[model samples]
Target: MTEPDGFRRAAMQWLEKRPDSRVDYSWVSSFEYEGSRIPLMDRQRGIRKPAGFEAALAIRTTFTAAGKLPPYVDAIGDDGLQRYKYRGDDPQHPENIALRNAMKMGLPIIWFVGVAPGSYEPIFPVWVVGDDPEALQFALAVDEGQRFLRPDFGLDEDTRRWAEGRTKQRLHQRVFRSQVLLAYNGRCAICKIRHAELLDAAHIVADGRPNGHPVVPNGLSLCKIHHAAFDHQLLGIRPDLTIHIRQDVLEEVDGWMLKGGIQGVHDTRLAILPRNRLEHPDEHRLEERYVEFLAAPVA
Candidate 1:
């Protein structure tokens, strides 16, 4: 689906702050049941209550960063409820008071159950609802857009066509992670590190956005520190798949450690090379970025 321009911008900003390193999702289930001592009957019935306020806050924080809202919010009705009103000159106006209320409660902007006041038994025991300026801004934007396109929530044919094109262009970084995992056999390309916790898919080329494309040829599999170094141009990989050390950096103590620890040994060949040569870095792109690296003053 085509997201609004403001939403797209906000999404990009949130994504940019995300680290290039990998995160282990394998242990997520363990943490889900932590510190819970509900009765055996409740556990057997799978009737775990909703998370506490702190837990909900954490979930919201993650969802916002991921450029999405919680799925639970999608249950508000089209007619709206309570202080929220869905019917007006611009019923589908994104900025409707009801829309704001739904979003504020982490509900979906679309029609669903449980969003209307007094619709069902309270699933959430904790009342953690507080003012969030970001959510408020999103609500306002939706409201204005709805008002502008009143009566019909759908965009004009021309606008809809344009949105379709934009939707295809929005790259999900998760795809890159998958590509890296497949390329390196799920191991860190450098140091032959097999521990999943220490491995990451490093971008051989810079991130594709603001003119970068998230293509396989532009990525690599390195650990967290190596990924940061590659991004900062603190490290470079030669076309021959050898590691290239900045001359000045070669003399520093930390640099020496890197050289001996990882960079020094990995010369002449890649620890984990892509099976498809076409997916490897473009020689020209590497050369261009490498030249820029050489021009930087030593710190």
Candidate 2:
């Protein structure tokens, strides 16, 4: 009914029309508003408050190394809500003020999380729920389910832990996938398949295992079939980057799909690798996982 409400709804509708993969930096940067162009985020600052808006438009969290939290970590807090740190220690700072205004107005905003260098995953309609001047941060709710949570809300400790763990896992997986896929240029390392929908960011090391972190170095971009094979120990990649198929599976007489798609790639090194050496799969993890593959029981 209100002008600001209309603008916010329009923005959400516009974003909803696009797939998550298409919401890159360029897509986020441009928006047409009232015959004028509005850049949703600042080129330098983490928080964006357009000149004409009473509240902030979007916030960003920059990319950090795997297993490392960014300078401003957006983690689920003790109150069972997401907490976003302020731009700086100043509560009265313009950016902080704008965010506070959004909370007061019940306005929704975008939360751009950096998945790789200069690349981000945009989460929209995150609401600023509570502001803590002492902590110099704001509380956020990503969905309607979280909007009603209060500090005094009696959440069972176990339930809280489960909620937090599940939320963190989903966020971490998304970021990991984005980073891994981007590093490999959206192509499967084993077969060089470039269809993103058919590709998955497979981990060389399981997340809870020793030295397992969801970083790019522990990831490989694999198509659905190869990913399933890797998980089932039907295929493995050595630290030397050589591919191996389980002996039985390799020796089996099978159709073209199994022969060409799986067995045909045996003894070959990864067809694709991250351009940045730092993003390459960790040799130690590869060796560790390869051992598991070798020990896997024959079906």
Report the lDDT tens digits of candidate 1 across residue range 1-299: 22222432332233334353222222112221223421111111111223322111111101111222433332111211111222233443433333344344543221111211112111111121222232221211112112222212535666544333332222124445555565566766666776767766665545534324444566677877777777777777776667766665565566565767545744445677666676666576666666666676666
TM-score of 2: 0.84
Residue pair clashes in candidate 2: none
Worst 10 residues of 2 by lDDT: 162-171
> Can you give the lDDT of residue 234 in candidate 2?
92
Task: Supply every candidate's count of residue pairs whose N, Cα or C atoms clash at under 3 angstroms.
Answer: 12, 0
**Local accuracy of candidate 2 as per-residue lDDT tens digits, 1-299:** 12354777777677777666535667766777677677776888988887878888898888886545568766678866778999789999999999999888888898878887677877777888888888778888776656655544667887666545554554567777888998899899998989989999898999757777678999999999999999999998999999999999988997999999999989999999998887888888999999889888988
Poorest lDDT segment (10 consecutive residues) of candidate 1: 54-63
TM-score of each: 0.42, 0.84
Off by over 4 Å in 2: 1-3, 18-27, 65-69, 76-82, 130-135, 151-154, 208-210
lDDT for 48 in candidate 1 is 21
